[model samples]
Target: MTVPEKRLHEDGDGDGDGSGANDTTALEEKRQNTQPYIKGIAGIKPEFLAPISSLSSTYTEYNDDEAEGGDRDKNGSQNGNGDKRRKKERGQNQKRDLKQKRDTVRLCVSLIDPEDESTPCVAGDEEKCKYSHNLEEYLASKPKDIDGMCPVFEALGYCPTGMKCRWLHSHFNKETKKLIKDLGKLETEKDKSFEVNLIDRESKIALQRKKYKYEISEQVIKYLDSKVQRNDSHQENRKENEATYVEQPFKIAEKKKIDLRGAKIVSPLTTVGNLPFRRLMKTLGADVTYSEMALSVPLIQGHQPEWALPKAHISEHPGFGVQIASSKHWAAAKAAEVIYRTTQHVSELNLNCGCPIDLLYKSGQGSALLDQTPRLLRIVKAMNGSSGDIPVTIKIRTGVKENKNTAAHLVDRVLNETQVAAITLHGRSRQQRYTKEADWDYIEEVGKVVKNWNEKREEDKEGRDTNPTWFVGNGDVYTYEDWYNGVAREGVDSVMVARGALIKPWLFEEVEAQQYLDKSSSERLSMLDKFAKFAIEHWGSDEYGVNSARRFMCEFLSFTHRYIPVGIMERLPPKLNERSPKFVGRNEMETLLSSSDYKDWIKITEMFLGKAGEDFQFVPKHKSNAYENTENR
Candidate 1:
């Protein structure tokens, strides 16, 4: 458990020769006396760890009102405190009225046609479509001139949201007295069929009919079950048959090796790692990207949301992986079967055994699999059997607890018993969270073990047909230096970035240049603009779509704001965990852009998407402790 104490710049760059010895001694003495302003928690000296209270309580608050105007009243009315309070009250009332008006404007609508045979209309069925059927009423309410058209209707031939869509007027042809349908824009019959399927009806029907079967998964699961049953029954004779069981070989289909050496991988982030974000990362230089962790049970049951996770943008090929979390072998196998059958974009199927979220762990999925090694093995084996040609990979942690490190043992078992193509180990245990630095020393130790195993396996087999499992290190890699140092030290093939990518997606760009990038405010704004365009393309440019884009934009801003511009930093290579003192940006726009307020994030989005409707409101996925001071605003 003892980590070797090494200086950050120990590799060499010091002038410590006999020449200018007196000058070097003086410089070293000065360096020892001078305290460097470390970013975030790295600034805390090891000696101060015990006396420091909660790290969360130490952050300095930045008051927007003070930043905006030094002496102006809250309302900018030049009035006394009473007048300012009254104006604030009036503003609150106005916001409430706007919210009420938006509530009255229904956004969801029925797309079902009562006359169509495929559209079921059941009387007294509470779940049946209750949307207004009177087209004339909707037509009369429409304005004389349409400002914008519905992009969904233009692309997909029909509007799925129907009359409730805010842009219905643009899609509806008044003279013809019917909704316009354009089939030419659709790329394939399958695409057209999916549009007609509407609300995942076809998927549901297929699931209910049992049309999809996990042929390979079932066979593997059955085989594993029989072995377990046989072992249990022959407990008394287990020692006699132990050698036979240990040497048992499992059948695996031939597949090409997956090589991800020096690849820039963006971890599959929940809520934030949508298709649009992955597409953006690909454009920025991400070599490998994974889908958000889709639950296997939902994918097997044909849930639309779960199925959507596996869908990759056309640009994200060659190294696109679909990650799934499952507690049971059947669910993992069935989900893999569906992906293999339905999609051709997947390069690998990754089992998520490192997620530390309580809900997932409590449900016997995610990091819980780390504790249940036998079940984890079965799930991977089943998934591999079902996923034809697509290699199975796994993402794991050091272990579940701080004291016990089981990842090396797990790696040994996987290498010996399974045909997994790769393994990614996040260097922290589930209990460690982000409080401590990643255990790179331990990761290096495990990497050595894997290397030895691979060498031995290669010596045994003259042919290189069998692919050695590639090892990847994850956790706390933020810059080119970190990536280089981790890979060089741990001997990992590559590293996966999660929050680092979120905070500064251009980390890959920095890695490509092998240096830090001090992006200007305008350049940063342009990046946001590009993301907004991508979001509009994926989510559509309609009112709901615009709002959805803005919400996610705000989410991105929440992370992006944490990026301290290199120009303003006191040091090189900012730490991910560092907090900054109150400071204004170089320009007003930059200052506004750097504001942690969600309202300011919306304003930034408005520069791209136009002004948000009065009805628009956004709550960040991860709540900010700073919001308590300005929540009323």
Candidate 2:
């Protein structure tokens, strides 16, 4: 038996066209040397042959840079057939990847159905008639207003008629309404504040595809099918078949040390790092999560509430690192000591020096530390020295202002001055604030520099088993290929995901499985419910706690909607920039995000912060597209 030979074959028709490229084949043939090549030695898997052999040569059929008359004469254009076929091939690969990615892990929500009498907790705080009766009896038995001092639950506001903290209930309720009214006003005004493009029903899929294209960018080829569209009848059947998909989760719990000496994480990207939310991320495959950056004074003061900022569930034990900001070394040391001594569960203590907001900066801390490296160094050294057994970390930016690129130098200083566990460098300068493309090339350069420095140190001191400090790359790693390139580019130990992780908790799910998940709205909402439970469980379930949870959930809804596969109620993965069928509740959040009006996003934010949102503004540390939309901030 003779085995056929294989190569990338193509049809070279006249006029440099892709015509008659019906099906060029890649026949697997055997090779021979001094010894004859055995039959079946090439070993192309039979099952994958159909897809592999279907593609003609992948050589660019347009450019003539290589050969005269080899390039197209028509306005730098490619033969339409080849372009279309290439697009189709790309789409097929993406679909296959999505399947693999979504198959990694599935998150489960714990919302109790109000109608389930057999259960104790009812729809998260709401009670059935029997429970309501019991609650009334319990409250009646308690002495009303015993201490005259409102309880933390009540002072922050949770008591009253019907067990509702009327203030918080009203606050959460009104914030939602105000957000809608503001959005309505924006619609009437039209493109004044920002062009609100709600991801709508008709264009949800188109928008999702567009977002995928933008996110993947140069990482992977997107094969789109047009001329030979899927068989609608067969497509529906196939869709139904694909709907029963689940992700196999990989639980990584080994105690690996982290390094954050010269790193930079957006200070307090809270919603995702909090309980339930962080757990969701872990289930989705996140490697690290910083506790919402805590305030140093409160933390060291032994304020019981400040511990809340640094608290973590056992699930987040090894991966959870507490981040805190301080202007003084003593305060930083005190906070680090308290956290290390108090929470036997936390893995590392992170020093946050990357925040750019005015309040924190003006108060002599946060990104302001960028302006004072010596002070920052002192704080880092203090934590590194004082944090016993526990590792110490730091997050830093490229520099204080735009012109000064201090990060590479800072990494050098940190290496020289402190023994940190890991570093996360947000590629943007303090001034840039998530406005532009990250300087990944510079980050790679810094990683190489760190590696070289480590080598030199080892050479200088023999027999000293100096562990390699982990260097995590941050900024704009949105897809599997992006992650693949970022992690493998140089000595980058891992990647710290902030917004991308928040937008799609399952993003790490893709990186681990080497694919993407086409999550539905119901699925995304379920994750939100888990986050809410985690928040309530962590923050407490009193009126204040519940209202705060609802409020933040609304804030999260802004980013979350961006990840919800559109057409959730009826379809899946809504149009990228189109509005949803309507903006109503959580179901409508995706549409609001699709619109890209920061006001709508901010309006949703007001749901937690309360009515006079116009008076205060939140500038996201890593605001994507903020360069073009700086006016919004």
Which is the leading candidate under TM-score? 1
Q: Could you tell me the lDDT of residue 628 within candidate 2?
A: 37
Report the C-alpha lDDT of model 1 over 317-422, residue by residue, as the tens digit.
7789988888988788878877776677788999999876655677888778989988898888888777878899999989999868999998889888777888
Write one digit per residue (lDDT tens) for candidate 2, span 385-435.
Answer: 456667777777777777578888888888886566676777777665554
TM-scores for all candidates: the values are 0.73, 0.52
Clashes of 1: 1
The alpha-carbon root-mean-square deviation between model 2 and the true structure, to one decimal in Å, is 25.1
Q: Against the unseen true structure, what C-alpha lDDT does each candidate score?
A: 0.65, 0.48
**Regions more than 4 Å wrong, model 1:** 1-35, 38-204, 208-211, 229-251, 621-633
Those runs of model 2 whose alpha carbons end farther than 4 Å from true positions after fitting are 1-256, 259-268, 460-463, 564-633
RMSD of each: 12.0, 25.1
